[model samples]
Target: MLLAVVLASVVFSAHAQSVPKPKEFYFDEDKTTARPIVVVEGEGEAQVQALVRERDRGRRQLEATAQLAHIAFSDGRTDLGGQLYQQALAQTDAKGTLGRAVRWNYAWDLFRAGQVEPALTRWVEVASAYGSPSWAPPTLALALWRLDRKQEAVAWFGAAVRTEPAVWIDARNFASQLPDWKQEDRDTLAEVLGAWQANPPTWP
Candidate 1:
């Protein structure tokens, strides 16, 4: 998830196929699952510099810019972050795995910034991608909940526990397990978990 973002980030060479593996930059090495990479708050100094160097040289240009954008977003620099994300995405393959990861970061940032509709819209693409993360159902549920789509929200929560059988059974587990999720998101998921527990989905 360590990509760069600059307005000049799109100038790619014909030999630009050396796409970096982004997971290396998604979080600190100790993280079990990915969370927002907050550069301004004591993490990822080395990786961020690496991205800047790569961006300067136009290597994996699009992805470097996107990753930088994520850093900016994490620091609450929303407008700059969004601009960088869009610029990098202009050359992105939305159907590709790399692009999905970028979309996930951007969508979550949008969600955090209270742009639910667009966030959910981007998530629709990510959800349909091959190898979508198991953590997705709760995210979908919370987004639907925020939009007042309660039935859909609860059903998605049910879908989550049906797969893991226990992982998302209690919202309280969410804090430790999903360390990257903001508290509001966890609370929203808790609401979904409660609703699902009350009336689990029944197949028609």
Candidate 2:
């Protein structure tokens, strides 16, 4: 009887150990992908980790890919920039915000490559994206101005000013980059610069 009681206890213990318990660890649900993510320790840590991951991944996603392409453009690697932009655009759908932004990036890439006409066309599309911030119009206008489309540039600038006066600050900064900016341009830029000096952006 003692041996039988010991055997029964042993079997019960083994059974309990074999069964799986319900998960107790808390994780955030990534609704977009339905993946479980452990909470990051802090925002700074998360951002740093994300940037590290981005570099390690070689910008596998559309947004990162576009950013990489922009960097390539800045470095004067026209062929590589175009290739990356095309790859990014191909991965995104028409309705995707990433797609629209990549399109704009590609356009800027073209402009940097000295393909001005195609860049203007791409800028027009960017200007039409739903819920695009008011800051975009002035930038687009500046691009048009660079192409010497004076009337259209002026109209777009007016739209930007009416929609978001803050964009004038951006226009001023862009103008400052020109090698041969005239006195008139400098005067206009100064006015915008003064405004920005008085009220700077809270966020970079």
Candidate 3:
């Protein structure tokens, strides 16, 4: 009996060890999940610096500049992020996916820095141009709410819900932060929240 119990414990321990840990996802300032940054193994900061050097030498300039911009934004260096984004945009096709991504990240940096107006403008651009990503509308709605545009904010909030049901929890949480929302708007948000709670969207 003692030997059997010990074997059972070992088996349990082995099974637990075999289970992989879930990957942690990070959100940007607007609570939008950030894209994963890929770094070369064993190179670390040296690899990023080498990429920047390669950009300066005009080899893979667009990719290098964008990656450095993302790193700067992730590190909270908005000034460097802005400059790098501009450099990348100059070399990228403004109507393409990469351009939209750079613009979105730059807008997020602006939002983090409290440049709400410009951030709103850029977010509007991103929504109009991309229109598919799940993050943009809710983020834009939060910006509008911050700027005291409650009506427009509520409209965008609904738009976000319709566009991405998976974001209902985040949108509801964000709506709760708007202290000056009218009672009617509050009621509307409450209804949406209750519905979402009852029928939660499946994770992608």
Could you say which candidate leads in TM-score?
1
lDDT of 3 at 98: 65
Q: After superposition on all CA atoms, what RMSD does each candidate show versus the true structure?
A: 12.7, 26.7, 18.7
Question: Mind giving the per-residue lDDT tens digits that candidate 1 earns over 48-145?
Answer: 78877767785577777877898877788999999998986677677765676677778888988888877877776766554435656777788888
Sort by TM-score, best first.
1, 3, 2
lDDT, candidate 1, residue 17?
A: 23
> What TM-score, to 2 decimals, does candidate 1 have?
0.72
For residue 31, give model 2's deviation from the true position in Å. Answer: 22
In order of appearance, the predictions have TM-scores of 0.72, 0.51, 0.57
The clash numbers for all candidates, in the given order, read 9, 0, 0
Per-residue lDDT over 67-117 for candidate 3, one digit per residue giving the tens place of the 0 to 100 score: 787677767787898888788778766557666666666676676677767
Model 2: runs farther than 4 Å from truth? 1-60, 165-204
Full-model lDDT, candidate 1: 0.69
lDDT of 3: 0.58
The candidates, ranked best first by lDDT, are 1, 3, 2
lDDT of each: 0.69, 0.52, 0.58
Q: Worst lDDT window (10 residues) for model 2?
A: 17-26
